[model samples]
Target: MKGFIIYFLLSSITGNPLMAFLGVIIIYSLIDRFYLGFLPDFTRIFRRNRQMKNSLKELQVNPQNASATFSIGILYFEKKKYEEALKYLEHPKLKDNETANFYYYMGMTLMKLKRSDEGKDYIMKALEVNPRIGYGLPYIALIDHEMEKYAPDRHIINDLEEKIEKFANTENLYKLGRLYKKLGNKEKAKNLFSKAMVEYSYCPKGIRRIHRKWAILSRVYKIV
Candidate 1:
């Protein structure tokens, strides 16, 4: 529809009826097949590169805008271009919460790239810059859990629990409950899950996952 409108406008400006109709059909067909349809891999790559180039141009115009850099970094990260994200996010102009978030996401990207030690270091730096951020803690715990699955360290779990108790936000509650479940503390997990269900009833992801976990646990305990 949008493509048709654009083609119509262009053809009207050029004052050519046959050209107008053909232009609309051609433009619409290309868009319907490539942009709206299952485009080829090369087309997807080309689009992504074009988007990155545009984002880079925007960043150049506003070099000190941490949000712009972060936005571009996020785009790169989504494309699995970790090196590019790292380069943009680690620019010295980034500071404050944006910088901290950049480090946290960089850690996640590094972890995805399978550089766990480097990821941990960046995540630790994120936490150090702002302990109250509440984002890096879960990543740290996740790394720890990955390293020693059976005997996961309790310190991260304990600290997270305390933070959840104090904050009681949806994210904190969900994380704490999952961490409890991972640590083989079923009773604690159940309680935390119940709390999460109440606190995050309106949140689709939290509600669904928490309720599913609660139902499973209830069945296991013969409570329902």
Candidate 2:
């Protein structure tokens, strides 16, 4: 309603409906980027690419540095260029330094590329390195992949519950709450959403800032 009013006023003043609509979109997008956190950041791709270039420069100075190569891979992954991400992540130098994150990222990228068997292996390796790695994201990804294959509802619920019980955080709690909502478990969803807010409050300031959007969404979902 507010957006329509703004659009109408802009069109009435400018006498150009298309230009006014575009203006409204730009204005709304800018506001959302800075304050609302509801819209995707369209400029993120350019910024990530710039970081990737800097990482490439680092490689020029030290050809054997896996850190630069890994950084470039992570940047590509952030931009959803999974194939390119896989290329750099799979670089021979990176193998010698395979941490839990390395395995998880490689596995997740492979899953995105439709290589599930190989992906699962790497994800399992990530778990072997650290079960609590990535705040339970590796386990959640496995569950998510299972869901894609029509895993039973009980199976998914068990998996999500186990992960949450092991380590509840804003990301997984809100995500599970959304899944519960989708499954028509309104009471369970609301409880999880409310718990997400409670858990968020206890997080360190830096982590809370990172997950602020999830906390806000949890509040909205709990109320609705």
Candidate 3:
């Protein structure tokens, strides 16, 4: 009702209903982009670009700045520039970092580079550092699939199942279920799909934002 009232007032002021509707849409999109986080954040990309530029400047002054190098690598990784990401992520200064996230991103970038074996190794290191890392299991499963291995790491799969049960991570369940399907385990896949649906149904409102995309995808999975 409030939206309609605003639309009506805007239409009266503009003397054109179509223009008013477009204006309302623009305002709503801005609100979602800034406050609701439902829209893509263009500002974040710009901010990252600015940070990357600053990191480059920092590197010119002190080539031994590991943090700046890692930051640049992360920025490039987010931009999907895997080769550039590797250059900094593999720097000697970072050899002893032992950060789980560092290894995880290195593994993911290597996987993108089609170096599945190296990717798998780094992913394993990440799991050793933090078994419960979000998305770690899924990437392991993905690498297993890429290598044409029927047996995904059972430890990772088991951990993901535990996470789903404890945290109601519908996304992980859905993805793991897809992995099972790809591995030709129809029965396990179907069971996980069912659980994913049920879990999404019972997902709490507070965490719905995290699960909503997977929940919607699971609905489509149910039909197919």
Cα-based lDDT for every prediction: 0.63, 0.83, 0.76
lDDT of 1 by residue, 75-148 (tens): 78878888877787677766455456776777777766777777777777777776655443545355444535
Question: Which residue runs of candidate 1 sit more than 4 Å off their true CA positions?
Answer: 1-53, 59-70, 78-98, 134-151, 179-187, 201-224
Model 3, 3-73: lDDT tens digits are: 79889989999999999999888888876654455566788889999999999999999999999999999
Number of colliding residue pairs in each model: 0, 0, 0
- Model 1 has an lDDT value of 0.63
Which runs of model 3 end up more than 4 angstroms from their true locations?
1-13, 16-21, 24-38, 135-143, 150-168, 180-190
Which one is best on TM-score?
3
* Cα error of candidate 2 at position 220, Å: 10
lDDT of 3 at 76: 94
How far off is model 1, as Cα RMSD?
11.9
lDDT for 135 in candidate 1 is 44
Any idea how many clashes model 1 has?
A: 0
Model 1: lowest-lDDT 10 consecutive positions: 215-224
Backbone clashes in candidate 3 total 0
